[model samples]
Target chain A: MIFTIVVVGGVIGAIFFIKPVPKYYTRYGVELGTNVQITYATSKGNAKQVVDEMFKKFSDYEEIFDPWLVGSELYNLNHSDGKWTKVSPVLLTVIKDSIDFSKLTDGKFDPTVGRLIPLWGFNTDNTRNWHLPSPKEIKDALKHVGYQNVEIRGDEVRLLNGVWLDLNGMMEGYIAQMLVEMAKKNDPNSTGFVDIGGTIGIIGPKNGNEPWIVGIQDPRGNPNQAIAYVKLYSGYVGTSGDYERYIIVDGKRYYHIFDPKTGYSNDYLESVTTVSTRSIYSDGFGVFSMVAGEKAMKEMAQKIGVAYYAINENGQVIKSANWNEYEYKK
Target chain B: MNTKNKFFSKWDLLLIVFLVAGLGIWIGIKQFSPPAAKAVILLDGKVYKVIPLDKNAYYKIYRGDTYLMTVETKPGAIRATYSTNWIFPQTETTQVSVATGWISKEGETIISVPNKIVIYTEGSKERTLYDAMTYQN
Candidate 1:
C-alpha cells in the first residue's frame, strides 16, 4: 500500500514538474512579396511586438534592396546612366558580398544577370506568357552580364556597360538574418526562428534542447511533402529550386536562377539547399550549387565549410559529407 | 547489509517500467495518430476562416464582398476555385487551376499572393518541413 502511494505521488510530481513550455508563433503573410513566419518562446509574451518590428525592418530593407521599385536605392543605381551612384550601407555591403560570391563561384552566381531576368520574362509576375527569349535578345543581355562590370568604391556603386544588379538571390537570406537578430534582441533568453519565403534562420534552439527540424521540399512531390529534413540549432538554411518558380514549355523547364555564361537557366540541378553559419553564404551557395551541379556543389560545400543537399535534374538527391549529420532522423 | 543491494527493489523496477510504458504510449499516440482535418484560411496575415474537412461544403471568400474566390472542402480534402483576382500589377489573371488541386496533407499550402490569400491544411500529425522555409522570389 505504501509503495502504491509512493508511485502515485511520484507520477503526480512528474506530471506537474514536466510542464510543457509555451511557444508563441506569429505568421505574417505577403511581406516583401513572400510570407514571414516567426516562432519564439519567451516568458514576456512580446512575439507580436518583435514580429512587427521585424516587418518594419523588412520594409526599410526592401526600399534599399528592391531593384524594380522605382524609389528604391537599387533602382536609382540601375538608372544612374553609367554614373557613380551613392548607395546605402546595406546595399553596399550586400553588393560587395555578391561580388565576392560571384568571384568565388567563378561567375556562376552573378548579380549582373539582372538584365537576363527580364529578357526571359522572369521579372514579370505573369508567368503564363513566359517564353524563351530570341538568341539575339539573349546575346544582347549577355553583353551586360558580367559581375566584373560592377565598380564599387566605398558607398558609391557604378555600373560600367549598363550592367543592372539583381540582389534577389541573396536578399531574403539577409532579411532572415536580420529578423533572427531582432528576435534575439527583443529577448536574449528567447528561442525562435524566422522563415522568409524558404530561407530560414534560427534565433536559438527550440524548447531549449532539441534542434529545430526543417523539411527540404521534394522537387517532384506535392507542396507539403518533403524529400528530407535537416536539424538546425542555429544559423541559416536557404534552398534554390526550379520547382518553385518555373515555366514549362515543350516538356522543358525554365526557372530564374540564371547562368551568366548562357543567359539562361542552368539545366543541371532541380534544387540545391545550403546550410551555413551565415545567411548570405547559405543563399549565395544554394544558388551557386543549383547552377554548378553535384560535383562542384560537394567541393564547394567542403571548401566553404558548409553543409549542402542537392537534387539533380534526374531527381537524385546528393549530400555533402556532413549533411547526414544534420538530418533529422525519425 | 550494503544499501546498493536494495537500491533497485521490485517496486522501483515496476515503477520505472510503468513510467517508461506510459511515455512510450504517449509518444506513439502523438506521432502516429491521424491529424484532425481542417483547412485554415488566412487573409492579410490574420485567420480569415477555418473549415472542417470532414464535410462537403463550398465557401465563398471575399475582400469586402468583392467575391475573390471559392473554397471547396470535401471529406478530408480542401481546394480553392473560381478566383478572379489579378496576379499582382501584372497582366495575367490568377489561375484557379493552380489553386484548385486538393490539399489533404499537413503542411500543404495554397497561396494566391496577389489576392493576399493563403490556405493551409492542418492536422495533429502534420509536421512542418522546416522551422522555416526560404526560397527565391
Candidate 2:
C-alpha cells in the first residue's frame, strides 16, 4: 500500500507541477502608410486570430483618420470648404486630443500645419521633388495654421480659418492605445505589444516577469542601429527624428517635422523620444520636443510628467530627470 | 536470518529510479531541443514568405512582376544583393543593402521602404534590441 501511494503521488506531481511554456506569435502588415507589427504571448494559441481582427479594426480607423487618403473622413473634412462636416467619433476624439496637445505645447505641436505640408512638397510621391516653399507661399500657408481655428460641436467639426487638420502625429499613438485595449480585452493574461511605425503600445509584461526592451534609434546611424535601450513593462514610446524623411539641399537637411511658428522643419534638435503612460502623450510630446528643442522639451516634459530623451544638433544627448529610470542597465 | 526484513525494500528503490528517470528525460527534452530558425519576409505589411534558415537558397523578391531585389541565404544567415530597381525618378537605388552583410543572429533586419520589403530572422533563442524601429515621417 505504501509503494502504491508513492507511485500515485509521483505521477500526480509529474502531471500537475509542470507548466506549459507560453507561445509567442508575431504578425506583420502595412497599414496607415507604415509597417505595423504585433507581437503577443498567449498559451491559448489565439494570437493570430486576435491580431487579424486588430488589423481589420486598424483599417477602419485608418479610413477615418488618414487625411491623405482621398475619401477618408479627414480628407473629406479638409476639402469641406468652410462647412461643418459630420465626422466619425474617432476623428472627433483625435482632433480634440490634438488641439489639447497643441494648447499644451503652446501651439508648438499644431495639427493645423496641414497647409504647410503640401507647400513643402511632402504630399508628393518623390522626395527629389521636395523643395523649400517660397516665403510668400509660406506666409499664405501660415495664415491658416493655427489649432485655435478648429471648432467641434457634437460630432461635427469645422475648420473656421479654412485650415486643414493633420492628425498624423497624434493618430499613431491613439491607434496604439486602441490596439493595446483590444489585446487586453481579447486575453487579459496575454503579454505583448503593438508597434505602429515607431509608436509602441505595451500590452503587458514579457512572461509576467521581464519587461520589454525597446531600443532608441540612433539619429546618425542606420535604421536598425540603436543608441540606447529602455525597459518598459507598460505604457507607450514614441520617437520623432530628422533622419527618416529628410531632403538635403545645399548641404542642409530639411526634415518633415515642421514648426508651426517658422512654417518650416525645425532643425534645433536631431531627435526626440517620449515615454508616457498614454500613447497620445508620447506621440504629441515627441513632435513637440522636436519642434521646441532641448530646453523647452525639458520644461514641457516636466510639466506634463513624461520621460524624454533628446539628441541635439550638436550630438549631445539630453534626458529628462526620470528618463534614466527606464534605461535597461544590462 | 529467516525472520529479518529491510524497512526500505527493493520496491521503494524501483519507484525512486522510475521517478528520477522520468523527470530527467522530461527535463532533457525541454532544455535540449534545438529551436527552428526561419527568415520572415514582409512585403507591404503582409507575410510574403517564410524561409527556413537551415539550408542555402536564393530568392528574388518582386512586387507585381517588377523585380525588386534578390536575397541570398547560407546556413543560419541571410543577405540582400543585386538590387537593380530604381526608385521612381530619383537617381538613388532602392537603398536596401546588406552589404555590411549577413544577418544570421536573430533580431537583425534589412528593410527598403521604397521597395516595401522587410526581412528579419526569428528563432526561440533570438533576442531583439527594440520591439520595433520608429522612423521619422
Candidate 3:
C-alpha cells in the first residue's frame, strides 16, 4: 500500500510538469490605412476572441486619427476656421503629444505639414495621383506650416493661420502601444506583438521569455528583404524609409516626408530605424532623423536615450553606440 | 518479506511505463510533425481562404462581387500579380503588393492596403529568422 501511494504521487507530479505549451496564433487585418498583424500566445485558449476585440479597437481608432478622412475628429478640427473647437480626448491627447515631440525634436518633425501633403499630391494612395508641385505652390503651403500655430486651451484647439495637422509621424506607435496594452489587460501572462505598418510594440516577450527578433528593411532593396535585425523583448521599434512612398523625376527621387522649412522631402537619409522604451519615440524618432540628417540624429538619439540604426542616401550604415544593446547577430 | 514494505510493485512499474510513454508521444507530435507550408489570406479582417503552397495555381480574390486581385502561388512561394483600387480607378497604382515579389519565408507578408487584403505564409519547415519586419510607412 505504501509503495502504491508513492507511485501515485510521483505520477501526479509528472502530469503537472507535462502541461502543454500555449499555441501561437497570428491574425492579420487592415486598419489606419496600413496592414495590421498581431501574433499572440494565450494559455487560456481565448486568443481568437481577444484578437477580434483588438482589431475592433483598431478600426475605431482609425477613423478618429485619419486626417484626410471626411467627418473624422481631426478633419473637423482642421476645418475649425481659427475658432477654438472642443476636441475629443483622443484628439486632444495626440495633439498635446505632437506638440511635446515637436519641442523635443526642435521642429525637425512637425505634424503641421498637412497642407504640404496635398500640395505635393501625396494625399492619395494612387501613385498616378501624385505629382511634383510648382515651386510657388509649395512656397504658399509652407506659409501655413508651423507647429507653433496650434493653440490648445483645456479641451479646445485652434489652428492658427489655417495650419492643418497630420499625426502620421506618431500615430502608428500610439496605436501599437494601445494594442499591446489591450493584449496584456486581457491576459496578463500573454506573449505577443502588434505591428502597424512598420511600427512594432511588444505585448510581452516571445513565448513569455524569449526576445522577438525584428528585421529592418533595406531602403533601396526589395520590400521583403532586410538589411539588419534587432532583438526586442519589450518596448517598440520603428523605421522610416524614403522608399515607402516616392516618385522619381529627372533621375531624382522625391519622397513624402516633407521638411517644414523647405516644403520638400528630406534626402539626406535613405532609412532610419529607432528603438525606444516608448512607442511614440520609436515611431517619431525615425521621422525626426530623416529630416534632421546624421549630425542631428546623433544628438537627438543621445538626448532622448534611444537606440538607432540608419542608412544614408549614399548607402552608408550608421548606428548609435547604444544600438549594440539591441542588435541581433545571426 | 511483506509486499507492503516494497518500494514498487509490478503494477507500479507498469503504471510508470504507461505514463512516460504517453508524455513522449505528445511531445513528438507537437514538435516534429508541424503543419505544411500554406498561405493565409485575409479580406477585411476575415479569413478569406487558406491555400497550401504545394502546387502552381492562380487564385482570384474579390470582395462583394468586386474583383480585386489575383494571387499566384508556386511550390514554395506566393505573390500578387496585380490589384485594382476602385477609389482611384483611373489613376495608376504604385503596385506595392506586386512589387513585393515572391514571399517564400514563413513570416513575410504581402499587403494591399486599399483593397483591404493581406497574405502571409506559415508552417515552413525552417523557422523564420525574425518574428516581424519594419519598413517606412
User: By TM-score, who's the top model here?
Assistant: 3
Candidate 3 chain B least-lDDT 10 residues:
B85-94
Q: Deviation in angstroms for B39 in model 1?
A: 2.8
Between prediction 2 and prediction 3, the one with superior lDDT is 3
Off by over 4 Å in 3: A1-14, A18-20, A43-45, B1-35, B85-94
Model 1, runs deviating above 4 Å: A1-20, B1-37, B64-67, B82-100, B104-106, B122-137
When just chain B is superposed on the true chain B, each candidate scores a TM-score of 0.68, 0.66, 0.68
Residue A117 of model 1, lDDT score: 78
Candidates, DockQ = 0.28, 0.35, 0.46
Which digits, one per residue and each the tens of the lDDT, describe model 2 over residues A1-330? 476576788779989997655677887766776667788876555788888888888779878887778998889999899798888777888899999889888899999999888887766444555677789999998999898899888889888788988888889999999989988987888888898888888998887767888888788876667888888899999898887666666667777888898887878889888889988887888888888888888888888899988889999988899998888865
Better of 1 and 2 by lDDT: 2
Order by TM-score, highest first? 3, 2, 1
Clash count for each candidate, listed in order shown: 11, 3, 0
- Candidate order by lDDT, decreasing, is 3, 2, 1
Query: At residue A67, what lDDT does model 2 achieve?
Result: 76
**Which candidate number would show the highest lDDT if scored against the true structure?**
3
Per-residue CA lDDT of model 1 for A262-296, tens digit only, reads 87787888888888998898788988877877788
